[model samples]
Target: MKKTTINYLHVGYWLLVLVQTLLVSLGTGVLGTTFDWRLFSQIVLPVKFLQVLSSAIFFYINYLFLIPVFLKKGNVIKYLPSLIATLLIFTPLYYFLEQRLYPMIGWKSYDADLNFWFAVMITLSSNFINIFLAILLSYLMDWRTMRIQKEIIEKEQFKTELAFLKSQVNPHYLFNTINDIYALTQQQSAEAPNALLKLSELLRYMLRESDDQFVPLSKEIIYLENVIELQKIGQKGLSFVNFEVVGEVNKLKIAPLILINFVENAFKHGTFNKKNNPINILIIIHEQLLHFQISNQINHVKKDKTGGIGLVNVKRRLSLIYPEKHELTIHQLENEFIVDLKIALYD
Candidate 1:
């Protein structure tokens, strides 16, 4: 995951390998009964040094060269033949060097009683196990790298999709609000100038602030208030909009433009020619929980496809950003449409 952590793991693994190698080499009576510093320095150390060097060479050949070139490419045909040829060439050369070097170090031959072919076979078998372990370790490292890469790609894709969803909200909302402003201008109402100012502020919020992954809850509330004001200007008669905030929204942050979708949907489908139809929106924060609810009397008979698309986009955004931390529920009663949403803000 982190470079320092990976370095530590590599250090630990090599230390373990070194300890195992030391135990294998020193466990035998090659150094004799008493521990002699001169004997260790002169003979035993040299023999062990040679052994480690040979093993390291073989190990790296498989780890660095063979595994990446052949095994990673899935070229079993070439991989097997290459391994066999390496063993064939290395076995005799290793045996010949050991034969010449052992006597000089006062090293007794364990394979002296055995035939040459048997000794060669034994060396080949041991070297094969070493190479196999090296290859296995290489595979494990490659797999870890691939898994980390996959997670990074998935996270980037999720952010891209969420941005796309957020972008959709701005254009759709601007279209509706512009229509409301146009209606007011046609009527030549005194509220048209105020509505245009509110529209500009709302546009500034959407264009500038909504680009962030999260925004202040207070700011979002102000945007909603502007939307409600714009909607009120276009409609006449008794006021049927009710918005209430029930907690101290000091440092709270939420996904930008998330709460506005439900309010827009309510206003689009809830209003009627009669003054009886009303839209109610409520927001409350208690501890780490943020709760939002919206309900409106449904006056329209047929459902618009655009509203459905907006809802789908919001749902997708919520799932991507909050996942298990948020719950959203929509209900349609006899004459009312309701949305209840709860979000865990701490995480």
Candidate 2:
């Protein structure tokens, strides 16, 4: 809620309390007598006004000072003693204004009709209710404020994690692409110029379009196609790479750079030994869900321990952004490594 709205609500609440206090004081009469203008102006208004003033004082004391200082800090020992002392001090003050001050203003005091101990107990009981209500209100407001702050902190953390994951992905992809371009240049292949052009387009997409939290599925697919084209430029004539998109991808949206890591990993490990087996990639979108599968022949002897950072970073990003909305499975067989990922987009 807006701060101004909260402030208006607070003002409304105090106005309501003031109105109710005025009605009770002006109607029925506190001294158990019929409504009389003279008595009201002389006795009831002054007496009830003083009582309401005392209630407001005690309420604010508990709400603004005592609750935050002692009760909120879990210092019950000090809280109880301080509360009792405040009530004891204020109860007598309320009694004096209602009893002793009446006679000084040329009106009969009610003290002669009631026992001293009974009056003191009655005053304390009434003040206790006001103070307790104030404490409860303070606690509820504090809890609400804490809850809002916690949500804000969690949102900031999520953004930071996403940025860190994207940073890792950018460097990893650029490093591998540069190596590919360098290899072509060393061989003095004519494909070097064309490969550099594809690299420029890929870099433009990464820098401009992929900055959003979610991008159109079509754009992601195009990016994957570009990556495959770039990777294929340096491959041998007998190497095989196939990419297929199976359902509609018109308006579907997904996290940027999520699927490329798996494709990168496939090419990195699948062709390490120059095997003739094909690397397969399939993406299907149906019923507001996306299913992606990739499989490749593994060269276990050429595996590097630190080369799995792309996969690790993608997994962490998936967990943070999608949480229970996505599922991932990996399988390693004697000759092939496979990955299956499913994500629900309706939510």
Candidate 3:
């Protein structure tokens, strides 16, 4: 049985016992002429005891027989009928013990109506009331419990997804930067030292801020600049990339790595072409609304499809972190792919 149902049944047990005690006392007063308060107390006490015993026995019968059949094979027909049958079975047994069995054990009987009619009336009334109450309470408790469990599950899933996003951002960045460094190592470039320095700064940022849900917008801008510098070391010429930031950052915190994947995607795909191809990034913050726009000039003649994993990861991260709080638009033209994102910042 559901928790609320059991609770209601428990409350009903107490109410029933109190009512029976009151009725038995009144009946004792009417049936006898002496009207001794002690006699009334004695009559009420055994009724209370018998009520408690009957409640315990009824609980056992419901637990052992009624619940299994009701839960598994029950329809509307079986539900009410089986409960009524169980009540009928137990009531006669109880009346027998109350009238004959207790009297044999030197316990005086209270009222001597241990017949079929009274047993049937009590059984039908009590079980009918219990059935109605139990079903309603059980349904409500089940609904409440289900809602609470679903909310807990969703929170846990969101946390797990956030952790996964952070992991994706850090490793994806490291792998790309390391690949660029490997190329510099092979070609013996003059900007290799600057690349290593920027790499170290990027690693520091990751270690410090990746574990947090939000980081200062200024910190994120610095980290983006570091990544851009590292990417520039591997570029063949300055014309390959262009980045600009126009924003006042005093007290704003945003989800980190929100803009890096676009830049990374741009460089990974746009760098191989030595033509006038360019990757443009512009970020502006105004009144707690940050607008980020990135456009990468793609060479459709020689476009590479191998650089989309980081972009996809970042998209997933943005969705998880900013459900209804951010807007992302992506457009793929013949020669360029553009991404525009507007995010709300919080302190």
Report clashes for each candidate as comma-separated counts. 0, 0, 0
91-203: candidate 2 lDDT, tens digit per residue: 66856775678666555545365455766676677676777788788978889899999999999998988888887864666777788889889998888888898898889
Q: What is the overall TM-score of model 1 with all chains considered together?
A: 0.80
TM-score of 3: 0.63
In model 2, pairs of residues that clash are none
- lDDT (tens digit, per residue) of candidate 3 on 241-293: 56777778869999887888887777655543454566778989888999999
Clashing residue pairs, backbone N/CA/C < 3 A, model 3: none
Please give, for residues 234-253, the per-residue lDDT of candidate 1 as tens digits.
66534478889998787788
TM-score for candidate 2? 0.74
Cα lDDT listed for each candidate: 0.79, 0.80, 0.73
Candidate 3 Cα deviation (angstroms), residue 26: 14
Which candidate achieves the best lDDT against the true structure? Answer: 2
Error of 2 at 157 (Å): 3.7
Query: The CA-based lDDT of model 2 is what?
Result: 0.80
| TM agreement with the true structure for every prediction | 0.80, 0.74, 0.63
